[model samples]
Target: MFSSGDLEQAKTNFPEASSRDLKGKLLLPGFIDPHSHFGMMISAIGQANVAPPPAGTVTNFSDIIVALENYRDAFGIKLSEWIFAWGYDETQLAEGKHITKIELDKAFPNNPVYLQHVSGHMGVANSVALAQGGIDENTRDPIGGRIICFDDGKTPTGLVQEISMYYFAGKAIEEFQGKKAELFPKAQEHYLSFGVTRAQDGMTDLLSMAFFRSLAAEEKLDFDLVTLHGYASLKNDDLEFKTYKNGLKVQGIKLIGDGSRQGKTAYFTQPYLTSVFGCEKDCVGFPHGPQDELNRLIGLAYEKGIQIFVHGNGDAAIDMVIRAHEEESKRLGQPLDADRRPVVVHSQFVREDQLNKYRDYGMLPSFFTNHAFFWGDVHRENLEDERAFFLEPHS
Candidate 1:
């Protein structure tokens, strides 16, 4: 605390400024989280109440099944509903492959299961869970994602990628019957305690937006919330996006370009470091924005004044995103507005050239630098030495 004389002298020097005699620590302002998936946070935090795994390497799908059963036993997972879990890494499994539907069925035949990949981009669901959600062999993949079907068979393999995961998983959330009104306030309280004044919620749609608005209306929302409404694809025929777009405090749409390094699905310029073959150039991850679709979506987004928030974890995908943006900008032949900072979210492997391209197009980026801390070793082992140097934070 300052003395009265000191206070007087300070005030005299800055007469127009106000002073705080407050006791608690005060924080400064920033962009806040300009986006996020609060739902994922809630789910992740909520899972702490669940079971624990066995004390060894998860050797295979069988081990995962046993571990989940053990975890469920410890956590009292009710058989009346589904068994939902996250933070499972496939690379560590015995074959370094994901758990299949058959393995899950054998263990928890009576219960439905939904295990999300650590990346939050893909998930494996048991047959019971798929049947509960009405995702079947005949169910075609949505515009943005592919439902991985076992080759030469009509049976669904239970691996749902990109958009399809959201589509069916959302329906599953509905089945849980948890209301947003009851959840958002709890989530907001958690955010405020952490000094978060703003956040950008990924995959936030109009329904979730209404929930946020309701919280604000009721004085429950403590932080300023913004979101990138993630879409399956921006095809003109999709009415859901248009409707949801009109209804939210959304900044734009998100397209997940490929899977994360943890999933070994990220597109790379070279082969995996662990792969026996020092071969397979252009080893890009599965392309979510194939060919002209990305271009078309950018044009549509620009025309509608909605920003594009693409999820590009691989350098190849980043380059594609930059190329698409550059093409769109050249075609428009004008500079974009400062606020309309079309962003590349998760620029985990952006090269210097790509960064230049981003600057050239007046684009903004949101890097998930956290990945470096989380999966740096795997990235180093799998990607070429030159490209691995450029991932995360994009510095």
Candidate 2:
């Protein structure tokens, strides 16, 4: 973590990349980010970055609008063209609140604008954008998603969560099919610049897999990438787990147990002290889907001989995953101590009991330590100080 040329060891070890744009940036050795989803970056290619500090320069709500406006003008986007942007974090804003559609409408009166939340679990859409997404006052919340509303409950507040967010993000990506066929060179170079050679995509949909395969055929994939296909989105169980091809591999099946904690959609045992955009009194967050569905999906993967990697950000969600594993083991009539190692990704708010259960079943745990550093302050405001302080406990 020193200045330019101060990392003499790195220069000497990888002399071949000495000329690949490592300037004044601090590069940590052996600091690999496992969840750098390359497919997401390709989908967001040529879009404005509105994330804070390290990712982008947007500090507040005002910066988001300005950045999008500039991007639209620079790209010569017509009023009829949809505006897409990513990396807007309400927690990092100076206002300490989520941006509203009112502000976006004022900025772009005719264009349909959508800003993706930093967590990738929620999004804010302008009124025009909402209409185009077929969301309206009469639109009901889907089984696994919610269309956050204003006080009236019927009218949307422009913010969509979970499954709802997926729809908007998917629609936006559909327009990027032209960009997906050709791998973006900078996408790989960006990670290389950070000295990260291997990364994993926790959730990969069918379309992304196709894009990955296309890039692999052309030898465009320049580094190792492991992707876990989304279980709910899987059309078949044909993926050969842990098999690599052209620097890319389909590692396993990913199941999302719940949403992000920072987004206040993480299922928890205790309720939040404050209210989220859609949740109020006694809000302990929610699961991404029903328990039976999760169990069925787990059983299906097990039958197909595919590995499972689930995302559980809260204690309740972790409980659900542990239960599913236990049930699956019982169904197979085999000892739980077998060599099978089901992964529990983002076991963020796991309790002591949950840890014991994980050990009892030999489930592998993947923690997000960055949560304590990046979102600790926000957690404190939303959760008990002790709970916030103990996030991603190393032990």
Candidate 3:
């Protein structure tokens, strides 16, 4: 290892040694984002942006409408074409309300509009969009999802949650496929601007995995890509673990235990302090599926020697995942594989007691600490004094 004196002497001797002058500045390694969805962000490049302050500053319903209208006009979008927008936050809106189907219809009478919520766990669709998806007032809510209704409980209010969000997102992505080649570079440029050298596509499906591989084969990607295939997507297919190809690699499998905390859908042991739009104060959020099913999936992944990255935001959901890990380890008659390193993504609401359990199970928690800065005050209002202070605790 060369010291500072040797480097200084070399700099003088070489004369042409190009280097940055970092006399008083602190230097650090390039940042790595372990939980970002690079592919999804890329696909959303051309979509209308309605995100609030710090992202786009679309603060109210009127702002969102104007943004969408401006996007439509700027692109000279056809009446038959769908208008897809991303990053609308109901909690941050001035009216503390979500845009309805009627509002979307009023804004774009001829075009179908789908506005995705900031949480990415829900979205609002206009009547045209609903009709396109074959969803109507008579349609029952899908499993682990809800179609928010009016006071009469018959007419849908346009907001769709959980699985329903996925259904609409799939349709939007299908439309986005035609423009992928053009948008991919834009997405990569956006990430590069933030100094991101390596990116992860957190929950990719089989089709997405293929697309990423194609990009790698064509030598289009400039940065390293690690993709975690969705567990559901691999159930019917006969796909095995793939190592590094170009700068791309199949990292692991992804499983979502619950939904978002801001959306009042993250499963919790206790009820939230205040009532949200659809859920009551007494309501504790529900899990995506039973614990046994999650356990089976975890066990199957472990047996196959594939790493699992579970999305568990709330304490209750974290508990369920931890239980599954414990059970699997016990059945195998040994501790978990340290190298595999099963991860609990967005472990925001983990409790004091759970820290020990995570250590015991050799589980790694990737906390979404950004929430502490962006939505801390909102969490305080929803969860009350005690729970709010403990959120994203340093200890």
Candidate 4:
């Protein structure tokens, strides 16, 4: 029971003490965060909340239309803009073809519409957003990404995946930048309330890093922060790796190797359950890291003392990361350190053999368990015999 004067004196003497006043229960050896995306978490909190289709109705596309209508009506949304919705599962939709742009236009004739997949990696925007993004029939897909278009006249049917969705959503993010920063303190407040004393600002770069540094220099950092700047950028040109040290160690590089299950492009070895009518070969998800480029990047990251944290949501992609790590270790003539424990975030589809390799290489896995409850059934349907069964298994 230290009084205000005693607390003030202690704070004055110990400037690095996180809490100026001790008002809560102090637990010994408290919480440590292995992984998190604080910026994305803040963005998610800011997005509009639309109710998902009822459990039994998800497999039917018409039911999704009904839910969308109900949601739009409930909010009294205007007809001029698109009806934006999130958490739609296309795997369960009727015919599993997903609600096409034509379908959305029919239901909400006056308004354009966009429905984001539950995975946040893919989405179907109406003709309005397609036009807004200047994505016409001739717009070529970006490297390592895809733009799903229609046949015959070759119109963009609004289905865009991976970074291609960036053409639209990234602009929205840029527009909301100032507001997003306003929400940063509130996100930090939530982290502190949950007893998260230390955190890694995962998947953020450039402007976001600048914002965080400004806050830190002003002595407003809410937690002991470790910012990770290598997300999607395999080169140091984007990461500015020389600027990191002990106070904020940028020791790891994050490589997004594939898409997620909900996005239906996780790059599995086998065909998806929804890929019917001679579509087996074309049904696989996109791969960010091709064989040769991945090897070069792995070697570069290793030589520079930057640990690799690859994101793999399918067996094929996981195999890619494992193979690169194998070559890296073999070339170096030694295994990585256990204490450092370079990680693979959202490692949801590693095979049984990969677990042993992980153990052998002293790699830690930060699984995205959030999907285990939300999309478990869809996973079971699509990857029943595949390697997804052991995701987050107890060993």
Clash count for each candidate, listed in order shown = 11, 0, 0, 1
Give the poorly placed runs of model 2, Cα more than 4 Å off: 1-33, 181-183, 232-237
lDDT tens digits, residues 56-148, model 2? 999988899889989999989998788889888888999888888888989988999899887888999998999988999999998778999
Per-residue C-alpha lDDT of model 1 across residues 320-349, encoded as one tens digit per residue: 777777677667764643346788877777
Best by lDDT: 3
Model 2 scores what on Cα lDDT? 0.81
Q: Rank the candidates by lDDT, best first.
A: 3, 2, 4, 1
Q: State the displacement of the C-alpha of residue 48, model 3, in Å, after optimal TM-score superposition.
A: 0.5
Best by TM-score: 3
TM-score for each of the candidates? 0.77, 0.89, 0.91, 0.75
Clashing pairs in 3: none
The model with the greater lDDT, 3 or 4, is 3
By lDDT, the better pick of 1 and 4 is 4
| Cα lDDT, all candidates | 0.66, 0.81, 0.82, 0.67
Q: Where does model 1 exceed 4 Å of error?
A: 1-31, 46-80, 92-96, 132-157, 231-248, 275-283, 336-339, 393-395
TM-score of 1: 0.77
Give the clashing pairs for model 4. Answer: 59-92
Model 4 TM-score relative to the real fold: 0.75
How many residue pairs of model 2 clash at the backbone? 0
Q: What root-mean-square deviation over C-alphas does model 2 reach?
A: 5.4
